[model samples]
Target: MKPKDIVLDFYKSDVLLDKKTVSELLHPEVTIDWNSSEGFIQMDYEDMMSLTDQMARAYIRSKIRISHILQEDNLVSLRFSHFVKTIENPREDMLLGNFFVIWEIKDEKLFKGFQMSHFS
Candidate 1:
Protein backbone atom coordinates (compact mmCIF):
# COMPACT_ATOMS: atom_id res chain seq x y z
CA MET A 1 0.00 0.00 0.00
CA LYS A 2 1.00 3.59 -0.56
CA PRO A 3 2.42 5.49 2.40
CA LYS A 4 -0.53 7.85 2.51
CA ASP A 5 -2.93 4.97 2.41
CA ILE A 6 -1.04 3.22 5.17
CA VAL A 7 -1.23 6.30 7.36
CA LEU A 8 -4.93 6.74 6.64
CA ASP A 9 -5.56 3.15 7.57
CA PHE A 10 -3.68 3.62 10.81
CA TYR A 11 -5.87 6.58 11.76
CA LYS A 12 -9.00 4.75 10.78
CA SER A 13 -8.03 1.80 12.89
CA ASP A 14 -7.33 4.08 15.81
CA VAL A 15 -10.78 5.67 15.52
CA LEU A 16 -12.45 2.31 15.41
CA LEU A 17 -10.34 0.88 18.25
CA ASP A 18 -9.27 -1.93 15.98
CA LYS A 19 -6.23 -3.43 17.62
CA LYS A 20 -5.79 -6.02 14.91
CA THR A 21 -5.58 -3.46 12.15
CA VAL A 22 -3.25 -1.34 14.21
CA SER A 23 -1.02 -4.32 14.89
CA GLU A 24 -0.98 -5.26 11.24
CA LEU A 25 0.20 -1.83 10.21
CA LEU A 26 2.91 -1.60 12.84
CA HIS A 27 6.26 -3.31 12.75
CA PRO A 28 6.92 -5.71 15.60
CA GLU A 29 10.11 -3.85 16.40
CA VAL A 30 8.79 -0.40 15.66
CA THR A 31 10.54 2.42 17.42
CA ILE A 32 8.31 5.28 18.46
CA ASP A 33 10.05 8.44 19.58
CA TRP A 34 7.60 10.66 21.38
CA ASN A 35 9.17 14.09 21.61
CA SER A 36 8.26 15.64 24.88
CA SER A 37 9.55 18.30 27.24
CA GLU A 38 11.08 15.66 29.44
CA GLY A 39 12.98 13.85 26.70
CA PHE A 40 12.65 11.57 23.74
CA ILE A 41 10.56 8.57 24.78
CA GLN A 42 11.15 5.39 22.85
CA MET A 43 8.89 2.34 22.76
CA ASP A 44 8.73 -0.97 21.02
CA TYR A 45 5.55 -2.70 19.79
CA GLU A 46 4.53 -4.28 23.10
CA ASP A 47 5.26 -1.20 25.14
CA MET A 48 3.43 0.91 22.59
CA MET A 49 0.29 -1.20 22.97
CA SER A 50 0.52 -1.00 26.73
CA LEU A 51 0.75 2.76 26.62
CA THR A 52 -1.97 3.03 24.01
CA ASP A 53 -4.35 0.94 26.06
CA GLN A 54 -3.81 3.13 29.09
CA MET A 55 -4.39 6.29 27.09
CA ALA A 56 -7.37 4.84 25.34
CA ARG A 57 -8.95 4.07 28.66
CA ALA A 58 -8.38 7.60 29.87
CA TYR A 59 -9.67 9.28 26.73
CA ILE A 60 -13.31 9.23 25.77
CA ARG A 61 -12.51 9.93 22.16
CA SER A 62 -9.54 10.82 19.98
CA LYS A 63 -9.11 11.64 16.35
CA ILE A 64 -6.35 12.76 14.01
CA ARG A 65 -6.91 15.06 11.06
CA ILE A 66 -4.12 15.28 8.57
CA SER A 67 -3.30 18.71 7.15
CA HIS A 68 -0.42 17.60 4.96
CA ILE A 69 1.21 14.37 3.83
CA LEU A 70 4.55 13.97 2.09
CA GLN A 71 6.22 10.80 0.92
CA GLU A 72 9.63 10.04 -0.56
CA ASP A 73 10.90 6.51 -0.93
CA ASN A 74 10.06 4.77 2.37
CA LEU A 75 9.69 7.91 4.42
CA VAL A 76 6.37 9.59 5.15
CA SER A 77 5.89 12.92 6.86
CA LEU A 78 2.49 13.83 8.23
CA ARG A 79 1.30 17.10 9.59
CA PHE A 80 -1.89 16.83 11.60
CA SER A 81 -4.05 18.06 14.39
CA HIS A 82 -5.40 15.79 17.08
CA PHE A 83 -8.56 16.25 19.07
CA VAL A 84 -8.91 14.35 22.30
CA LYS A 85 -11.49 14.34 25.04
CA THR A 86 -10.57 12.78 28.32
CA ILE A 87 -13.13 10.85 30.28
CA GLU A 88 -12.18 12.64 33.45
CA ASN A 89 -11.96 16.13 31.96
CA PRO A 90 -14.77 15.67 29.44
CA ARG A 91 -13.39 18.60 27.48
CA GLU A 92 -11.86 18.46 24.06
CA ASP A 93 -8.22 19.38 23.69
CA MET A 94 -6.53 20.10 20.40
CA LEU A 95 -2.87 19.52 19.63
CA LEU A 96 -1.22 20.40 16.35
CA GLY A 97 1.92 18.54 15.32
CA ASN A 98 3.99 17.11 12.52
CA PHE A 99 5.24 13.52 12.52
CA PHE A 100 7.98 11.86 10.52
CA VAL A 101 7.75 8.09 10.18
CA ILE A 102 10.27 6.04 8.29
CA TRP A 103 8.79 2.72 7.24
CA GLU A 104 10.54 -0.39 6.01
CA ILE A 105 8.28 -2.71 4.06
CA LYS A 106 9.01 -6.29 3.28
CA ASP A 107 6.67 -8.57 1.33
CA GLU A 108 4.00 -5.88 1.42
CA LYS A 109 4.16 -5.76 5.22
CA LEU A 110 5.74 -3.13 7.36
CA PHE A 111 8.83 -4.68 8.92
CA LYS A 112 10.27 -1.70 10.73
CA GLY A 113 9.32 1.86 11.58
CA PHE A 114 10.98 4.81 13.27
CA GLN A 115 8.95 7.86 14.19
CA MET A 116 9.34 11.25 15.77
CA SER A 117 6.87 14.05 16.31
CA HIS A 118 7.17 17.79 16.73
CA PHE A 119 4.37 19.86 18.17
CA SER A 120 3.36 23.28 17.02
Candidate 2:
Protein backbone atom coordinates (compact mmCIF):
# COMPACT_ATOMS: atom_id res chain seq x y z
CA MET A 1 0.00 0.00 0.00
CA LYS A 2 1.04 3.62 -0.41
CA PRO A 3 2.35 5.60 2.57
CA LYS A 4 -0.82 7.61 2.94
CA ASP A 5 -2.93 4.49 2.73
CA ILE A 6 -0.85 2.83 5.41
CA VAL A 7 -1.23 5.85 7.66
CA LEU A 8 -4.97 5.88 7.07
CA ASP A 9 -5.03 2.21 7.91
CA PHE A 10 -3.33 3.01 11.19
CA TYR A 11 -6.03 5.48 12.17
CA LYS A 12 -8.74 3.18 10.91
CA SER A 13 -7.42 0.46 13.17
CA ASP A 14 -7.44 2.82 16.11
CA VAL A 15 -11.00 3.91 15.40
CA LEU A 16 -12.11 0.31 15.08
CA LEU A 17 -10.04 -0.70 18.10
CA ASP A 18 -8.29 -3.23 15.91
CA LYS A 19 -4.83 -3.76 17.30
CA LYS A 20 -4.10 -6.61 14.95
CA THR A 21 -4.32 -4.36 11.93
CA VAL A 22 -2.12 -1.76 13.54
CA SER A 23 0.43 -4.39 14.44
CA GLU A 24 0.49 -5.82 10.96
CA LEU A 25 1.07 -2.42 9.40
CA LEU A 26 3.96 -1.51 11.65
CA HIS A 27 7.44 -2.16 10.29
CA PRO A 28 9.61 -4.59 12.17
CA GLU A 29 12.11 -1.82 12.96
CA VAL A 30 9.49 0.77 13.76
CA THR A 31 10.27 3.59 16.15
CA ILE A 32 7.97 6.19 17.62
CA ASP A 33 8.89 9.45 19.29
CA TRP A 34 6.00 10.83 21.26
CA ASN A 35 5.65 14.19 22.94
CA SER A 36 2.74 14.99 25.21
CA SER A 37 1.80 17.00 28.30
CA GLU A 38 3.08 14.15 30.43
CA GLY A 39 6.53 14.05 28.84
CA PHE A 40 8.49 12.75 25.87
CA ILE A 41 8.75 9.07 25.13
CA GLN A 42 10.76 6.99 22.72
CA MET A 43 9.71 3.48 21.89
CA ASP A 44 10.64 0.70 19.54
CA TYR A 45 8.40 -1.79 17.75
CA GLU A 46 8.20 -4.19 20.68
CA ASP A 47 7.38 -1.37 23.06
CA MET A 48 4.68 -0.18 20.70
CA MET A 49 3.14 -3.64 20.56
CA SER A 50 3.13 -3.91 24.33
CA LEU A 51 1.64 -0.47 24.78
CA THR A 52 -1.06 -1.16 22.21
CA ASP A 53 -1.96 -4.36 24.01
CA GLN A 54 -2.41 -2.48 27.27
CA MET A 55 -4.37 0.28 25.56
CA ALA A 56 -6.69 -2.23 23.93
CA ARG A 57 -7.68 -3.50 27.34
CA ALA A 58 -7.99 0.01 28.78
CA TYR A 59 -10.01 1.37 25.91
CA ILE A 60 -11.90 -1.60 24.61
CA ARG A 61 -14.55 0.65 23.09
CA SER A 62 -12.56 3.78 22.44
CA LYS A 63 -12.74 5.79 19.24
CA ILE A 64 -10.20 7.84 17.35
CA ARG A 65 -11.43 10.52 14.96
CA ILE A 66 -9.11 11.82 12.29
CA SER A 67 -9.67 15.42 11.38
CA HIS A 68 -6.93 16.16 8.87
CA ILE A 69 -4.60 14.27 6.59
CA LEU A 70 -1.66 15.21 4.41
CA GLN A 71 0.94 13.31 2.52
CA GLU A 72 4.24 14.04 0.70
CA ASP A 73 6.31 11.33 -0.82
CA ASN A 74 6.77 8.68 1.86
CA LEU A 75 5.75 10.93 4.75
CA VAL A 76 2.24 11.31 6.07
CA SER A 77 0.84 13.66 8.70
CA LEU A 78 -2.50 13.56 10.44
CA ARG A 79 -4.44 15.37 13.13
CA PHE A 80 -6.89 13.46 15.30
CA SER A 81 -8.62 13.05 18.61
CA HIS A 82 -8.71 10.00 20.80
CA PHE A 83 -11.94 9.69 22.77
CA VAL A 84 -12.10 7.76 25.98
CA LYS A 85 -14.30 7.47 29.02
CA THR A 86 -13.63 9.75 31.95
CA ILE A 87 -12.08 8.32 35.08
CA GLU A 88 -14.87 9.27 37.46
CA ASN A 89 -18.11 7.45 36.79
CA PRO A 90 -16.97 6.66 33.29
CA ARG A 91 -19.50 7.05 30.50
CA GLU A 92 -19.19 5.87 26.90
CA ASP A 93 -16.57 8.40 25.74
CA MET A 94 -15.63 12.01 25.97
CA LEU A 95 -13.11 14.03 23.96
CA LEU A 96 -9.80 13.03 25.48
CA GLY A 97 -7.75 15.47 23.43
CA ASN A 98 -6.17 16.33 20.10
CA PHE A 99 -3.04 14.82 18.65
CA PHE A 100 -0.80 15.02 15.60
CA VAL A 101 1.35 12.33 14.14
CA ILE A 102 3.81 12.43 11.25
CA TRP A 103 4.77 9.03 9.99
CA GLU A 104 7.59 7.96 7.71
CA ILE A 105 6.72 4.90 5.74
CA LYS A 106 9.52 2.63 4.60
CA ASP A 107 9.13 -0.56 2.66
CA GLU A 108 5.35 -0.05 2.60
CA LYS A 109 5.07 -0.08 6.40
CA LEU A 110 5.13 2.43 9.21
CA PHE A 111 8.84 2.81 9.88
CA LYS A 112 8.95 5.83 12.17
CA GLY A 113 6.58 8.35 13.71
CA PHE A 114 6.78 11.63 15.54
CA GLN A 115 3.66 12.48 17.48
CA MET A 116 2.43 15.15 19.89
CA SER A 117 -0.69 15.53 22.00
CA HIS A 118 -2.59 18.29 23.78
CA PHE A 119 -5.84 18.69 25.68
CA SER A 120 -8.21 21.60 25.35
Highest-scoring model, lDDT: 2
TM-score for candidate 2: 0.86
Across 54-92, the per-residue lDDT of candidate 1 in tens digits comes to: 767767776787777777766666666666676776775
TM per prediction: 0.73, 0.86
Alpha-carbon RMSD to native, per candidate? 3.0, 2.4
**Candidate 2 lDDT by residue in tens digits, 62-114:** 66788899999999999999887534536667777799999999999999999
Best-fitting candidate, scored by TM-score: 2
Candidate 1's C-alpha runs over 4 A off are 89-120
Candidate 2: residue pairs that collide? none
lDDT of each prediction vs. the true structure? 0.64, 0.82
